[model samples]
Target chain A: LAKTTQPISMDSYEGQEVNITCSHNNIATNDYITWYQQFPSQGPRFIIQGYKTKVTNEVASLFIPADRKSSTLSLPRVSLSDTAVYYCLVFSGNTPLVFGKGTRLSVIA
Target chain B: DAMVIQNPRYQVTQFGKPVTLSCSQTLNHNVMYWYQQKSSQAPKLLFHYYDKDFNNEADTPDNFQSRRPNTSFCFLDIRSPGLGDAAMYLCATSRATGGYGYTFGSGTRLTVV
Candidate 1:
């Protein structure tokens, strides 16, 4: 399992674009970068995942550099309901997930 | 919609008593996972079952045990509940490992008296 480092918390205003970056300096070649969002009193929900390059979905976009050592989650036009804790995880095939403290995003009106 | 279902959203157990938490899934996934999350803390993986094969985490306590009778049902048994055991237990299922498209239940909040 690879360790990830992200901000403890971040604050943004409504309609602003938010980018949360995660660094996994020792990421393995087989590992994939995944992101999850968790709200109050609920289980973590799958956000986006990518092995390399950029992957866009209906909810968010994942950008992975060529080095694969770091990735960024881009949330466009944030809203008050977007407030939640975001987790970045790195895992290979057939392995359990390891979660960190995660980055808490607070969206203010 | 296919989803993961957990029974008894809130559970209250007495100290030193044994309790079991049940999880069922309609997704028919091959892997099921149990996680314990305390207040203001990250969800910690306790163990998982990959089609009847059990995989327990290295740091998980001995008192925590799990049983997967079949593909649709899995159970978490706490032999001796203590005050520290009170937390939210989340059940999740995935088609396979690598954490792909995991569907998690609403979770069962356990309280120890």
Candidate 2:
């Protein structure tokens, strides 16, 4: 499994755009970058996933470079409820999804 | 809705006692995973069952065990609950093909006292 690295914490104001980046230098050829949001006492919720370039969903957007070594999760117009730990996982069918020390995004008022 | 469900959202067990956490999924996914999450820590994979085949993580302790009966139900058995074992136990399901992310249950908060 590919190991992922992310910021320990980030602070963002409400209505601002927050971008959290993850680095997976050893990503595999078939790996996909997927991001998840986890609130207090709740399971991680899928935000967005992408293999390359970009992928957007109703909740967030994922941008991956051509090398696929890094990916970014962009949350637009954040609110206080968006404050949570965000995890970036790199995995394929053959590998289990392993979580790193996620980025705790705090959406400040 | 078709989703992963964990029973007894909260559980309190005596120290050295045994406790079981249950998870059921309606999605009919081929993979079922168990994870343990402590305070302010990332979720740690305990084990998983792909169909009837059970896979255990190399680092998982002997105190932790899991059983999957049929396709919809899976159980986590903690042989001896210690104070350190008090944490949130999360159950998730995913398809064998990957791409799609795992669907997680709300998690069962276990308190060992």
Candidate 3:
């Protein structure tokens, strides 16, 4: 399983765009990058996923470089409710999703 | 909406006692997973069942066991509970072949007394 490293925590003001980057230098060729958002006392929810380049959704955008060593999750126009812990995971077929110490984002009004 | 559901959102268990947590899914997903999440910590995989095949994480303790009777229901059985076992247990489901994201339940908060 590939390990991931992310910032321990980050703070952003409401209406600002927040980008959380994850480094997985040992990422494998078949590994896909996925981001999950978890609020207090709630389960982690899928935000976005991508294998390479940029993949945008209604909720967030995932940017993966050609090397696939790193990926960024971009949240546009953040709100107070967006405060949560975000996890970056890398997994392939039949591989269990291993979670690392996620990035805790604090959104302030 | 099709979703994963965990019964008994809150449970209080006695130390050294056996307890079971139940998870049922309406999505009919082929894979079901159990995860333990402590306060301020990342969720750890305990075990998962791909159809009828059970896969346990190497780091997971022997006291933690699971059962998947069919496609929709899976159970987490703790043979002997300890104070350290008290945490939020989350159940998630995903398709077996697509390698897509998991759909997680709200989680069952277990307290050991």
CA lDDT of each prediction against the hidden true structure = 0.95, 0.92, 0.93
Q: For model 1, what is the C-alpha lDDT against the true structure?
A: 0.95
TM-scores of the candidates in the order shown: 0.99, 0.97, 0.98
Which candidate do you rate higher for TM-score, 1 or 2? 1
**Candidate of highest DockQ:** 1
lDDT of 3: 0.93
lDDT of 1 by residue, B42-109 (tens): 99999999999999999999999999999999999999998999999999999898787888898999
Q: Which CAPRI quality tier does the interface of model 1 achieve?
A: high
Error of 2 at B61 (Å): 0.6
lDDT by residue (B62-85, candidate 2, tens digit) is 999999988999999999999999
Q: Cα lDDT for residue A75, model 3?
A: 98
Q: Which rank order by lDDT, best down to worst?
A: 1, 3, 2
- C-alpha displacement of B75 in model 3, angstroms? 0.4
CA displacement after TM-score superposition, residue B15 of candidate 1 (Å): 0.6
* Candidate 2 residue lDDT tens string, A27-98: 999888999889999999888888999999889999999999999999999999999999999988666678
Cα RMSDs of all predictions? 0.7, 1.0, 0.9
